[model samples]
Target: MSRDLHADRVELSIPATVEWLLLARTTGAAIASRWSFTYDEIADLKLAIDEFCLTLVEGPGAERLDLAYYLENDSLCLEGRTVLATPGSQAASDSGATGAVTFSADLSARILDALVDEHGISDGPGDGAKTAWLRKKRNPLS
Candidate 1:
């Protein structure tokens, strides 16, 4: 069985950084959302998600990035995907790729980590395209 209660889809343009930030905040609000996070925390979430976005966009050329949100009874799942291509089966082997982030970079990532409970990424060559995914759990304590 599935635990999700709701779903949302947002289209993001790679050049529009502000729009990306807005999407991050709105996504946070939609799931495990509370009104008490500090400014730094909010900023961190944007940065972390931005890294996720950048990483997803690095190897492949995406005309537009598709964002998806899954709201479950116990958690909110945030994911992004693009129909870009990678040189190899694993993006890591591709020089065009970059590294994943630690949870200590910004307050927002911390807040997201706290709220989402867990996060992950899975990248590979799929159906003649390269795709990467970033996912976060909705923290119960959040």
Candidate 2:
């Protein structure tokens, strides 16, 4: 399906640090609310955002995260991508010398599937960056 060209969209950029995850979640909740999502739906959206953003930020080399919130006709769509720091860069150094961090993809998928209408996590094409996206449809009964 094609997206509406005039759809409302908000973009946010935050440092790829655990401390900044709250900012991402708050932004998502705010946008979701504006779209008239139910409180429980908003909570689910926040949790899904946290899980996906944490997966990116907790890993080494991520310097920042870019998020886009799209207001669709009957749903809210969130797309987040990580910007990785170059090797030996200050940003990379600040991310800590700890080895790669890993998360259970299956678990994450299950959680996301339960929370949103649709979701995906994938590595950006040839960029080494990771992207996570989700769409939550508003309940008509609400």
Candidate 3:
């Protein structure tokens, strides 16, 4: 069976830093709200993205963050990709690094899982790159 096209598709690429997270949040909220997601749902999308970025900012070789938003039937799907810092390299030494933040992968995953209906992580095309995704379905009650 042929699938329907996305209602909308947006892609953004920015430096992977805390200061740039606002852009991601704004884009997500705009898309979600335009797609008829409730206010609460929009807030959840922003929060989930904030948390997701926190993990990426701390990742080694995370120089750039790329995100794509797709509006699917009854759901919004977001896919993110970033290159990982090479092993044994001090890629996290820049001023962007605040203190030593030890974030657990499992913990991050759990938080994302709670925020969205579905979440996924996988290896990117580039070596040492990682890709993460989240999907939030429109609430039937809303």
Best by TM-score: 2
Put down candidate 3 lDDT per residue, 31-128, tens digits, no spaces: 88877789999999988887676655655566778899997768888888875556664554454422356656687777788889887777766865
Two-way TM-score contest, 2 vs 3, winner: 2
Model 2 residue 132 CA deviation in Å: 2.0
- lDDT of candidates 1 onward, in order: 0.46, 0.78, 0.75
Q: Can you write out model 1's per-residue Cα lDDT over 1-142, one digit (the tens) per residue?
A: 9643355444443321224445654555534244334444445455556655554545424333556555445444456665543444333223323224332235534544564345655654454233544444433454
RMSD of each: 8.1, 4.8, 4.9
Write the candidate numbers in order of decreasing TM-score.
Answer: 2, 3, 1
TM-scores of all predicted structures: 0.46, 0.80, 0.78
Task: Looking at model 2, report the run of 10 residues with the lowest lDDT sum.
Answer: 90-99
How well is each residue in 64-88 modelled by candidate 2, as lDDT tens digits?
A: 7899999676878888888887666
Error of 3 at 64 (Å): 1.2
lDDT of 3: 0.75
lDDT of 3 at 49: 80
Candidate 3 to truth, TM: 0.78
Off-target runs (Cα >4 Å) in candidate 1 are 1-44, 85-117, 123-128, 139-142
lDDT at 69, model 3: 93
